[model samples]
Target: MKTRYTYGGDEHVYVEVDDEMSLDAFFIGLSLSRLVREANIPGVTEICPANASFEVRFDPDVIAPDEMMARIKELEGEAQAQEKRLDTRIIEIPVFYEDPWTHETLMRFRERHQDPSGTDLDYAARINGYDSVAAFIEAHHSQPWFVSMVGFVSGLPFLYQLVEREKQLEVPKYLRPRTDTPKLTVGYGGCFSCIYSVRGAGGYQMFGITPMPIFDPEQKISYLKDFMVFFRPGDIVKWKPIDRAEYDAITKQVEEGTYAPKIAEVEFDLDAFNKDMTGFNAKLMEALNDA
Candidate 1:
């Protein structure tokens, strides 16, 4: 893929991997960003990798903008030549679908929704060709999702469904941004799923809420003890739909500082996944289950 390099002011260099969003494009950008980080070019301050592009912040006094761009271009070429592999972790996040919290929240913002007559889950189900909400939920948790980017709020992960293009779930954002979204609410917009890390304004369609907290400033949770943020760009997420009882149980454990998210380490190969997505994903899930 051809990359477009541009300047984002005097201190930042922007690299666009592709004109549109795709798993292939995201992986390419990810590869380039990883290579850049590994290279540890002097004067480079920050490396921000997005869905289809990446940006680098640097001090021009230490390394000229032209030289920085050249180094990135070289790394991009190297990224393309190498086999795309990522050492990532698959984490199981339990969600309560159509939970009352998000249901009440969405209902409060009906005037801003595309379909106000029904809940967000119902609207999404109808548009996605699922006969019922249960089927839609089934489709959602059946396949693991890729953490394409981690932003929009600290530790909030933007996820891409790991399915063929035709099978991906797509949803439109709210007509207008909502003044409030419940914390930990699992939201979907434009084929990406995200968990609201904190209670704040949002536009994504609210599906459900997860009991596990992805962000904690106090770093109380065991998994989040090392860092307040729990997710990274390359992490894989598997959704396990749960009922209200289980949700409450997990919530209690979390409050007592006992819950730890289910996670398993695995390596992902883009070429192998492209050849047989089903088989590769199954193996990945098996590893998660075995863990």
Candidate 2:
């Protein structure tokens, strides 16, 4: 893989791991970012890792831009030499597919959708070659997703499916961005899935809503007490579909500050996963279930 190094003004350095996005490129960027962090290079104030690239912020006075780039290049070599494995956590998020909240929002923005006559779910199903909406939803939750990036809103996670490249789900965003998307709305665009942390403007196709809160400024929920943001880069997510009753129950617990997301610690080996995605994911799911 080739990497492109560029300066983001004078205080930040932007590094592109590859010209295009891929799981390989993402892992390389992730590994490089981890190396940068562990190196403890002085003047490096912040590190932001994205899908296929990463950015580093530093004080120009402490570390010259040219020197910072040199250090990162060295770390990049080290990153390439290291094994592609990460100790991460897999989380189970309960979702109510085709839930009424997002349904109402999507209906209001039909004119901006690719297929105005049909619902987003139906349009996605037909385009993806699924016989029914249930099958489409099943395809979504059946495979685990990786948190490729987390942004656009505080604590909003952008997820990429863990299946092979051909099996990945792809959807187009709304023709025009919507003025309102319900909070916790599970949205999909391109090959990524996102949870709208707050009700705001968005362009991704709304699929459903999760009862759990991904972000909370007050940090009132038991799970969120330590940190307002619930997700981090490299985290694995499994979507678990739930009915209205379960949704309501979880919502009640959330309001009472008792809701906690299901999470289990696990190790992810890129090489092993690439060799046998099914077997690896089954093991990951087993860990989640056993926990």
Candidate 3:
């Protein structure tokens, strides 16, 4: 598909790579955004990459809108010619599936969910072609997810599973948003998965909770020392299912400032993954397991 360039008001420029969500579109946005950052255009103030598109905020006085658009077009061409790989890190995030807290929260807002008669996991499992919640949970943890974008909150990560389209899990959001969502709540909406950074209002289907904090204003955690946000656009996240006992242990470690998450550095080749997802994901999981 061709990339569409448009102006966002008078100070921002937007580039849309695809209408549908895909890894290729995400990588294109990532590549162009990185190239634009490297250019260090004087007028550009911020770069925001989304699921299948990216936007740049610029100072119109320093650089005209037309000039910025031209520069973006140039960068898009450059990105197409650049390497197909992106430097990324693999993070193993621990999750307690069917956890009590998230389950309670969902139960409290059952009227807001599409399937008011059953729990969110039950509804999700049925729609995803799984016979039971256990099988659904297994599918979720069976593959690694790519952090396609980090937004909607300070550190909320929008993840896309690294699997073929046919194997992708899909779910719908709640009919109405919940007034309160616990911090680190693992939620899913449409075709994407997300980890709520803080307790607040949300509409995604509640699944479970992670003990670790992805966002810390104080940055006390060693892993978040470089950046308060634990994830970036191209980061790979693997969710591991843990029991309540292990979850409590990790929570205690987090409280004591002694817990360290498993993390590994790896190069993600978008082209290779698109060509051979099964093989690429096997290697990706190996890297995470090695970590």
Query: Poorest 10 consecutive residues of model 3 by lDDT?
Result: 75-84
Q: Please provide, for model 3 over 189-213, each residue's C-alpha lDDT reduced to its tens digit, 9 standing for 90 to 100.
A: 9889999999999999988999999
Better of 2 and 3 by TM-score: 3
* lDDT value, residue 41 of candidate 2: 96
Summarize candidate 1's per-residue lDDT along 1-291 as a digit string, tens digits. 678999999999999999777878898888899899999999999999998899999999999999999999988778776667789999999999999999999999999999999999999999999999999999999999999999889889999988899999998999999999999999999899999999999999999999999999998887888999999998999999999999999999999989988999999888898899999999999999999
Better of 1 and 2 by TM-score: 1
lDDT of each: 0.93, 0.92, 0.90
What is candidate 2's lDDT per residue for 1-291, written digit by digit as tens? 799999999999999998766878888898899899999999999998998899999999999999999999988877777777889999999999999999999999999999999899998888888999999999999999999888888889999999998888889899999999999999999889999999999999989999999998998778888999999888999999999999999999989877778889999888999999999999999999988
TM-score of 2: 0.91
Model 1 spans with C-alpha error above 4 angstroms: 60-67
The local distance difference test score of model 3 is: 0.90
Error of 3 at 103 (Å): 1.8
User: Candidate 3 has what TM-score?
Assistant: 0.92
User: What are the C-alpha RMSDs, in order, of all predicted structures?
Assistant: 1.9, 2.0, 1.9
Clash pairs (backbone) in predicted model 1: none
The TM-score of predicted model 1 comes to 0.92
